[model samples]
Target: MKIICTKSNLAKGVSIVSKAVPSKTTMPILECILIDATTDVIKLTANDMELGIETRIEGEIIDRGIIALNAKIFSEIVRKLPDNEIVIETDMNNQTMITCEKAKFNIAAQSGEDFSYLPVIEKEDNIAVSEFTLKEVIRQTIFSIADNDTNKMMTGELFEIDENVLKVVSLDGHRISIRKIELSDSYGQRKVIVPGKTLQEISKIIGGEAEASVEISFTKNHIVFEFDQTLVVSRLIEGDYFKIDQMLSSDYETKVRINKRELLDCIDRATLLIKEGEKKPIIINIGDESMKLQIKSQIGSMDEEILITKEGKDLLIGFNPKFLIDALRVIDDEEVDLYFMNAKAPCFIKDEQQSYIYLILPVNFNAVA
Candidate 1:
């Protein structure tokens, strides 16, 4: 198989599919990138069983054949090659030659017939969303997913589609992040749990073009994302998601409306006095029209006050500063509303429309340093 591709196009295709290449795999074929030039377009594919990616590049296919090359070496070679056309040819002895203007390198290749390909998914149950919106949603919620595998469901996000509204939710034991988006067209109701790894990779690959759309299709156990010249297929996490609606409440005895940036910066500064891995809660005293934040740790102590519009009742609460920072960093609003039910109940940070909601469980101040 022989194909002549420009360095820029080939490098882009390789970089996009390389996300699926496994760092360590018992099967060597899983570490290679399959190049299929038998069709009109030059296709590159990489699959690590759980996730698979395929992208087409614009190039000239001189010979109709297929070969698999090591993804690491191939990507490095293409990236370092001169900014010109690159010729890749495979011979009968399973040897692949990469040539540029003056540089040439030969590497062993594997037959593409032995490579595993992405599963074929039916496009009947599908939804179209703007590339920009999809990327933004993932960025705003992926951070809250559990990093451990003790609870499999916590490592993934729930994708629920009800008519024209799409809701994405991710939660760890300590906090929950929810983002709801409105779609342009309505479709059948569907719900699935997508692995966090797949969404993270897709976010990096998407160009974030507000006008461009991404077609997403779901089956019983698989999900597919198609955008531009690339496609991503991932295995769905099987199980029922948590009933989050019951945990959300609109009742609050106290409410505070404060500048988002000011509160975030105050929490950020308080965290500096606390040491890593130390259980020091940021104690907040909410009064009539102001809130005071204080933190005491082994290293030192800090106290600050921020003016807020308060109503309902005055209260004292304690929370993990990291949780507050995480939710605040993702929010784009100039001011945010916080609802509290006594000092033990979880805090709710959101807007009036409820487009985004963050629930953070409070820490016990008596036990915290």
Candidate 2:
């Protein structure tokens, strides 16, 4: 394979496809990116079996062929190159050579035949989603997905596409986050659990572009995203996502409306005093027109008070300070509507506009120090 590509263009394409490269993949071919030189375009592909990404860039293709080169080496070489067009070629011995202005490199590369073919989605149920809106949904929900891989479903973010309204949900058995956006288009209805890593890749590709919509497809066991020339494929988790409404509280013993920024700042300060791995529990005492926030850990303690509008009886609740911070961040309004069934049940935080709701399980202190 022989191809001439500009360093800047190659760098961008490599960066996008590198998201699918496996760090510890036993299959050497999976760690290497497939570089193909067609008549007018150069294609780069990387995959870790379950997820794959392919991106193409305009290049001067002297010969029509393909080769698989180590993604790590190829990316590093491109980064080090000066601002100039570079030529890459694969000889009969199966070694790949890279040459720029002064620097040159040759590395043993695997034949393109050894590289696995990227999967193709034969039929796609197309839907148009605003890239900006989609990116925010990913940011809010992806962070809440469980980092543990033991349970597949828990590691994925639940996506419910019902008609024109799209709902995104995520949880780690401790807290739950749900964000809903009502669109103006007729998208029909569907639900799928997309892997967190896949969503991260898609979000990275979508920048601050004025593109009206990003195309997406939900297949049986996989989800496909087509944004311009790049395509991302991710395998869907097989299982039912947690029922969000089931974890919500029906009644509230205490309710308060507090400034979201103040509460977030309090938690940020309190988390510092809490030791790592130690439950960073922050006590919230809600009363008439005010709320007291305090945290006590082995390292130190913190306390603060924020004015609020309280309508129910006063009650104290303990929660993971960090979880509350995440839930509060999704609310764009100045104040957040808080509700708790009791000290033991999970608390619900909603936007004053009643557009988004976040639920967090309360921490039970058998004995408060």
Candidate 3:
């Protein structure tokens, strides 16, 4: 295979595809990136069996052929090459020669036949979303997905598409983050569970440009996300996602409205005195006009008072300070609404606009009834 391309364009294309190349794998062929060259476009593809990315760069293809080269060596060499036109050609003996203005490098290459076949994006059941809106939606919810390997389904975010709204929900069994955005055009109905890493990468690849658009769709086992000259095909977390409808309680006896920044600060300050491995959860006392957040550890403690509008009798509850702070950081609204079903039941939180709902399973402090 042979191709000539500008340094910056090649560097950008290789950098994105390299994210899927496995650093170490038992199979030897998985370490190489498959490069396909035609007269008009050059395609670079890499996969670690779980996630894969393919990018097409606009370059002059001298010959129509395929070659697989070591991803590590090729990427490193291209990144440092001068910002001038570079030429890469493969010899009959499977050796790749990289040439720049004053430097030449030779490395052994392999045929593309040895590489695994990447999954094809079969159906184009597409949806349209602006780059900025989708990027912000993923940023607001991706942090709360589970880090451990307990329940496989819970480790990823549940994305549902129906009619005119796209919803993202993530839970670690203790705290759940739910977000919703109205669609620009009705795209019919579809549902898929995308892994957290894929969502994070796509969020970054979008580059926060509001004018750009992403074409989204899915097959049975994979999801295809297409953007400007870049495509990400990620394996889906196939299974039934837990139903959030029944998981959250509908009955509420108390409601408190407070400033979002003030509540987040109160929880962060309370967490400072609570030492690691200590059972010192933050105690929240809610009344008619004010709310108090306090934490008492062995050596130190914190007391914070925030103004609020409450509508029921006074109540006190215990919650993990770290979890509370995490949920608060993702909210974009200025004010937050808190719901209670007693001191022992799970507490629900929503923005002042009531657009999205968050639930936290409270810690039991009183003796069992």
Candidate 4:
């Protein structure tokens, strides 16, 4: 394959598709990025079995052919190349040559025929969301996704579409994050479990422009995201997601309204006294007018008080400070409402409209104190 394109366009295409290149793969072809010049526009593709990305770049196709080159090497070469036109050509022996203004490199390439391409996904059940909204939703909930594979469902987020509402849910045993968004148009009901890795990659690629939009299509086993000149396809995690409704409660014995920044800062300061991997919990005592937060750890201790508007009854609870910080950091509200059911039930931070809901389980007061 032979293509002549500007360095900027080529580098952007390579960076977008390289996200799917597997770091450790048994299949050698999976580590390469396929460059297809048979069509009008140059197409770059990378697939690591579970996820695949394809992006089109404007370039002059001198030869109608295809080849797969090492993603790591190609990306590095393009990134370091001078700000000039780039020419890539492949020979009969699969030897690929990259040339810029004054630099040239020859690398071994593989046949594109053996490269795995993205699967065909039906575009029937789809919805359009602004890039800004989608990126914000992923950022707000991705931190709660489980890092381990112990529970596969918890490692991914639930994408549920009912009418014009899109609800995203993610949890990691300790806390649950839910974000609801309203779409401009309504579509068929669909539910899918999208892998956290896929969403994280898409978030990075999307520019989060309020005017730009992304079209998402969902099939039985695959989900497709199309935006700008790029397309991403990922296999959905199998099995039904956890029934989160049963775990979420609407009842609370005490409710307190506090400044979001004040509470977040208090918890963040308390974290300083606790060592890494320590199981210390931040104890919160809610009174009629103010809330006191205290943390005692091996290194030291912290005690602070923040004024709050209280309703219902007074309560005391303990929770992992990290969980609170994660939820609070993403919230854009100036003030937040906290609801508690005695001291053992989960604490909820949400607005009256329920646009965003964060549920964090409390630790035993005695266990920490």
- lDDT leader: 1
Worst lDDT window (10 residues) for model 3?
360-369
- Those runs of model 1 whose alpha carbons end farther than 4 Å from true positions after fitting are none
Question: Which pairs of residues collide in model 3?
Answer: none
Task: Kindly report which residue stretches of model 4 are placed more than 4 angstroms away from their true locations once superposed.
Answer: none
What TM-score should be assigned to candidate 2?
0.95
Question: How do the residues 1-369 of candidate 3 rate in per-residue lDDT, one tens digit apiece?
Answer: 788998998888888888878878997778888888844679988888888989988788888778888899999999888989999999888898999999899999888878875787797577878888889888777777898878887789998888888888998888888888888888767777888888887886777788988888878888888889988889999998988888767678898888999999878877777668776678888977899987777778688889999977799998877777877887877988889988878888886444577788778644310
For 165-198, candidate 1 gives per-residue lDDT tens digits of 9999999989999999999999889999999999
- Whichever of 2 and 4 has more lDDT, that candidate is 4
> lDDT scores for all predictions?
0.96, 0.83, 0.83, 0.94
Error of 2 at 303 (Å): 1.6
Candidate 2 C-alpha lDDT tens digits along 306-335 = 999887789988888888888777667887
RMSD in angstroms, all models? 0.9, 1.7, 2.6, 0.9
Over the stretch 208-297, how does candidate 4's per-residue lDDT look in tens digits?
999999999888899999999999999999999999999888998999999999999999989998878879999999999999999998
* TM values, all candidates: 0.98, 0.95, 0.92, 0.98
